[model samples]
Target: MSFVVAVDGPSGSGKSSTARGVADRLGFAYLDTGAMYRAVTWALLQRGVDTADAAAVAATVGEVRIDSGTDPLAPTIAADGIDVAGPIRSDEVVRHVSPVSAVPQVRTRLVDLQRRVIVGTDAPGIVVEGRDIGTVVATDAPLKVFLVADPQARAERRAAEEGGSDTAATAASLQRRDRIDSTRAASPLAKADDAVEIDSTHLSLDEVIGRIVSLVEERR
Candidate 1:
């Protein structure tokens, strides 16, 4: 029996980190659903597929093969056997991911792959983190969490993670992604009606992890 925790949130929110912690604490496999999409976007760019061309995306997509480990520090993302660990996070790839992720065809393909990965093993459960895990891909998950923080705080978190990238530039890019993600018609980043919403602006990392762990422990 698979028990999945679907964590959805905007960029720079604590979803990814928090989910990884929960997964580690509970011996659940963690899935970075966003990276899967980013890898696809990076692959399409390498093939020169037009981001705006749905048909082109559909055609070249079968060439992409991706996998992610539950260990957040060692999380590996590859396309066609190539470790795209570097290119997947390049500015170009990040810029195009929202649009690529917006395509219904792209979501359908990636979502299927994600489900397969989550259920492929005999593991007890999974901690899945993404923009729409709760509302779209893993709506039936036993625990659904929606993480949100002040936009400025989110931007600051992203800037620090960039490791010397100009704060203003990275923040601008993040803002653009947020707008695109929020406005997209297909399974946009949103809080599901039944999800537990957590405002993480002031919470320490350990604090957030502890709270989610308690929530799961109490429920299970």
Candidate 2:
């Protein structure tokens, strides 16, 4: 069986960068499940679909084709045959992603696609990261990491990533997303019972990546 590592955490918790680093070091495929949601949300907004309407969002989700590249060194995501790696990161898409992801139909569709990607990976293993990877997408993954950081740290990191956007506003947005993700009826953001929780509040990026790589080695 292919070894799988599931890294789950809320926004700005270093899930994406850390997971990508681990995958690069281990020669494993990397899947950013969050980007999948963003791709769908981007498509919805581009098509003028009302994200707030559950039925409309669900109906439109199936019509959009989302593709994720598994290469850790240069991961890519596209929606409806258009390159959307940059577009999905726009402020508009970010604002709607959580709500679009909350729709059960959207989750059901993307979760199936994610599983197919995991099973079909040509690498010896895969590092998958997102809010519910441990609890929902890859429950049977051999290594599950619940990465976390204090709100202040997370906000600072995110602000820096966004070209030094307002830290206070970023923190508030992260808090709002936390509430929505944790309370969503469909696979909520949560740590799996057996997951290893790692607090990245005070850890450097290299340090955090090294720890997770070490954990993966221990599992192997």
Clashing pairs in 1: none
Q: Tens digits of per-residue lDDT for model 1 on 1-220?
A: 5788888998989787888888888877888989899999998998899988877887777777777766644577788778888888787888888888888878888889888877784668788999888998888888898998887788888878777677678678878888889999887988988899989999988888888888888777
lDDT of 2 at 83: 96
Go through the candidates in order and give each one's C-alpha lDDT: 0.84, 0.95
Model 2 scores what on Cα lDDT?
0.95
Q: Report the lDDT tens digits of candidate 2 across residue range 1-220.
A: 6789999999999999999999999999999999999999999999999999999999889999999999999999999999999999899999999889999999999999999999999999999999888899999999999999999999999999999999999999999999999999999999999999999999998999999999999989
TM-score for all models, in order of appearance? 0.94, 0.99
lDDT of 1: 0.84
Q: Which segments of model 2 are wrong by more than 4 Å?
A: none
**Lowest-sum lDDT 10-residue window in model 2:** 1-10
